[model samples]
Target: MGGRFQSLREPVFRQWFFSSVLSASGTMTQGVAVSVLVYRLTDSGIAVGWMTTCTFVPLFLFGSYAGALVDRIGPRRVLLVTQTLLATLSGLLAVLTATGAEQMWMLYAIAAISGTVSAADASARQVYVIDLVGADRVSNAVALNEIVVNGSRILGPAIGGAALGLWGVWACCALNAASFLPPLIVVLRHKTKTVTHPHTQKIGGLRYVWRNPTIRVCVLLAAASGMLFSLNVPLTPFTTAIFHLDGTGFGLMMATFGIGSLPGVLLAAAGPSRPSGLRVAVLAVATGVAILATAYAPTVTLAFVGVAVTGCASIWFISLANTLVQLESDPGMRGRVMAVWGMALPGFSVVTGPFIGWVGGVTDARLGFGVAGIAMILAAATGWRGLARPTARTPVTSGASRA
Candidate 1:
């Protein structure tokens, strides 16, 4: 165990670990704060759905462009600007809520702006990890990042729930917003570094992805899997509707999922260095199966257990898929490739949010969960061949060769 632990002690991994811890905690807190605030103000399921959509829609719309920008300007500078903007946005939201002057539209507008920044920020962050750790340890680094992020998923919601109960949503938002300061400060203190990439023909990142068969398949898989995974967003409302629960119940459910994800992260971290695409495909399929089982869970306890398994499988698939993308992409186009990945990851949710909500609105929330699971299973099964094949090499320019 000690030897295993020591292997993760590289400087780049250390930096990535710390950064992920701070950012993940902040993000989780922000999620709880936003959900509680919107639910309180509107008390409407659709409103909550829209709030979730607001966070994801920008990623879908602008993620590719953001990736291109990350490559052009470098990820370090991009992180500085986006993290600062996110912190400021959080503070503004805190003030609005604290003043009792908060309106629904104001929340919507703020969410949209924040979402735009997140798209770019996320792309830059993904590419930055490769630059920080180099390609060799990218898989381990990604798994460690997942561990941190999911760990936050465990801690942040618990803290947010307590804060929301004791101090109200305004205070939670204030604290959540302030959480970004640590990462921003950490980024600012680091010296600027150059990221080299191969100069490729300027094309939309999504277009570039479409041209690569393996990448294209992975992107499509990510999109379908993303939609399935996102059922949790709407699942909160479903739980409330069925169990007649409150914010605390929602928090507990998220916490349960978080708990389940921790072991998955560790497992992924401890797994083989080079993971095959088939492993990722299997994980995706397993995630869908877990969700399918959860849909039939008669008790909240059973549902929690089901979600926990789903969390484990989902994170494993995501971490592996992400690792594959980073490893296989040309460094020059890495930012764009990651952005394309990001776009597919979150973009589908934006379009599916209202649709899922409508599904819940029309029939039952479980139906939405069922549909999402089925879609993922079908997608994985269909794309199995592409995913199973080894990645093909593309011609690289001199700059890309160095990268």
Candidate 2:
């Protein structure tokens, strides 16, 4: 155990890992706080859904552009700017909530601005990991990133909720805003310089992805996963209404999913390099099945178990796909390619959020979950053959070649 722990203590991994943890925790806390705040103020499922939509819509509209920017400018500078912007926005939100001047529209506007910054930031960070850890350990690094994200999911909501209970929502937002400092400081302090990709032109990355069959299929699979998994957002209303639980119960349920995700990350970390498309397809099907099972769960305990299963499947699918993208993409185009992947995930969420909310408002939240499951299964079935086929691999160019 000591040896294993020591291996991750290498300087490059340590910096990236610590930065990832801080960013993930802050982001998770912000998500929960925003969702809960919107729900409390509006008491409408659609309104809460709108909050989520506003937070992601920018990715769809500006993802390609953001990718181009990351490639041209380098990841380090982009991340620094992103961290500063996020901290400022989060602080503004904290102050607004504290003063009781927080309104629904204000929340929406802030979420939109934050989401725009996040889109560029996410693309940069995804590509930056390659610089830190080298290509050989990309899968392990991706898995570790997942672990950090899940750890935050486990702790962030619980902590945010506690802060909300003790000192009001403002406290949670304040802590989240403050949490950005560690990563920003780390990025600013890094002595090792980042190298920029040669291609600064806007359309190059998009053209490359359009021409690559494997990358295209991978992006589609990710988008489908995004759409299907959106059921979780609206499902919160059902759990609260059906199980007669409160915000604390919602936090605990999310924590349960986080618990199940840890093993999936470890599994990915241990696996050898292989084309991940087929693996992702299989995991997508499994996730859909798990969601279907979750819809039928009659008790909170059973529902939590179902969510745990879904979480494991979801993590495996997403981690494998991410690893494949990072491994197979042209280094010059990686930032943009990753931006496309990030866009698909959040972009689908923006469109699906209101629809899922509508479904829950009209009938039952279980119906939303069931429908999403079916959609995911259909998507997986349609793409199975394409995803399974072996394709020519792209060689890395630019600084990534050094790895």
| Index of the highest-lDDT prediction | 2
Q: What TM-scores do the predictions have?
A: 0.86, 0.86
Candidate 2 on 1-403: residue-level lDDT in tens?
Answer: 3322332655766766876787688777777877888898988978986777787889887888898888888888898899899999999999999999999889999989988998899898888777765666677778788878777866787787788788888888888889888877767776334567755574665677767766776777777666555646666876776787888787677677778777777777776654467777788788889878987789888999998887788787778878887777877788889988887786877766667767778988787666667767887887777778775565543332222
Can you give the lDDT of residue 143 in candidate 2?
Answer: 77
Residue 197: error of model 2 in Å? 2.5
Roughly what TM-score does model 1 have, to 2 decimal places?
Answer: 0.86
**What's the distance in Å from true for residue 57, model 1?**
1.3
Error of 1 at 327 (Å): 1.2
- Tell me the tens digit of each residue's lDDT in model 1 across 8-28: 666544755676686677677
lDDT of 1: 0.76
- Residue 302 lDDT in candidate 1: 90
Off by over 4 Å in 2: 1-9, 35-46, 99-105, 191-193, 198-207, 237-252, 296-303, 359-365, 397-403
What is the Cα-based lDDT of residue 392 in candidate 1?
55
Per-structure clash totals for the candidates: 1, 0
